[model samples]
Target: MSNSGTPPRRLSTGGQPPIKFLLHYVVEQVPSRNGRTPCFTAWLREELASGQITTWNDEPIRVEDTRPEFAIQVYDTTTPPSQDSGGDVDQRLQALAKALHAETRGEREGPPGRDRDRIDVWGLPLSADLSDEERIATCKAHLLAEIAARDGGETEFPIERIGNSFTFGRALYIIDRPPSRWDEGEGGILELLWDVNPGYRAMMVHEFGEKYETYEYEPIVTRVTRAELGNQWLMMRHGASR
Candidate 1:
């Protein structure tokens, strides 16, 4: 729960390019009668099969906070992907980041007074350590795990890579077709963009529509940490079936 007036800070992408992958996650506060106990925490406990996590961003992941009822932090990998691999590193990272963003926070539009789920997305620099092949493989592995979790062990709808674009060696674009249940259309598309120079920039665009209806697009901005990112990936990997 970020303050309405103060926007959460975006991660700085300038100095010390990412050498490791980190995932940051945030969940809206779940209400309870007795008191507020973050449901996200309970969900994480079930997925990890252990309630104990020692650190996040070099500090404890669990800390007291008045705002943002639920949060998670984790890392995808401490070492970079192998280099001998031939693949688009930026595209793969962008796809994972966009997918994570969509999973945690999707588009929502409804009348007033209606309760809805909210989540945020944070973009960090792609780790320079992993090789192109490694990055692509890592992204595919994570996506497969997520698809399995979402499809209840039935992966009828496989993750699809639409395409990607690179701009003047500074900007990167990635598109993905993820699983969906809309009877009117095939599935949803996630688009991600990243720029390195003149300060790092990241953006996400989600598009979906019914068969006869015009497509709907939503843009998002918010960031999470490595640990939180990891938590989301794990939840998608382990919690969806439960």
Candidate 2:
């Protein structure tokens, strides 16, 4: 946060209007004292710089919001973002995901995709016992290997997560190869489904809003090649008579 930008204006006490403070979570126009605003601003910057304001566990500050010089009426207020607001959707989503992932709230906007059309790709099993951190690490590993096995493994190529959404709950990785077989009239699809669950609440966080899809069926699957299978296979023989 460089001070190269426009300086924050001093607020008024009696006659002047409230100055707008545009925080990422909420927006507000607040009135400040004639003198203490400078002190408060400096203190806030210091607190942020010292890794105090951002952390999950922080001690309460001694500063008071109530006073003749510093007082606010409303508990909460918000305003719509105007054009040329310079707001960042990615930053807001990251901040909200960091906060909301730990909470048990919010609603899903809709299904992940049109019934059975999307979210069909799969990979390794994500154990329910694993934490979110563990699951993400596992996903990164699986995706890395999958890409390395394909032409996309090149370092210069663009690689991204299947879907950049904040998801939680018990889920497993099922590579989409088997479903392609199922659609192709292959008989082995049932073997892959033995360990698979009935369904999962596939929740996701997006820039627009939160959404979820009842995940069950997928269309595509990774198909193993005959050459790869033959090299590892051994022919069996037996002698019936001496």
What's model 1's TM-score? 0.21
lDDT string, candidate 2, 1-242, tens digits: 11212223222324534332221121121222222111010101111222223222254432212111111110000111331132442233223222221121111111221111001112123344655445444544543453445433433222222121212111222222322342353321211111122122222222223343433343222222322211111100010110
lDDT of 1: 0.28
Residue-by-residue lDDT tens digits, candidate 1, 1-242: 11122122222234633222222332332222233111111111101113434454686443323222222221223223464132343344334433444444322211231112222222222365655445444443443444345454433222222112211111111122212321124222222222221111111122222321332222221232332333423323232211
Q: Which RMSD does model 2 reach against the true structure?
A: 25.5
Question: Model 1, residue 135: displacement in angstroms?
Answer: 1.4
Model 2 alpha-carbon drift over 4 Å, by segment: 1-118, 152-242
- Per-prediction CA RMSD (Å): 20.1, 25.5
What is the lDDT, from 0 to 100, of the residue 28 in candidate 1? 33
Candidate 1 Cα misplacement greater than 4 A, ranges: 6-128, 152-242
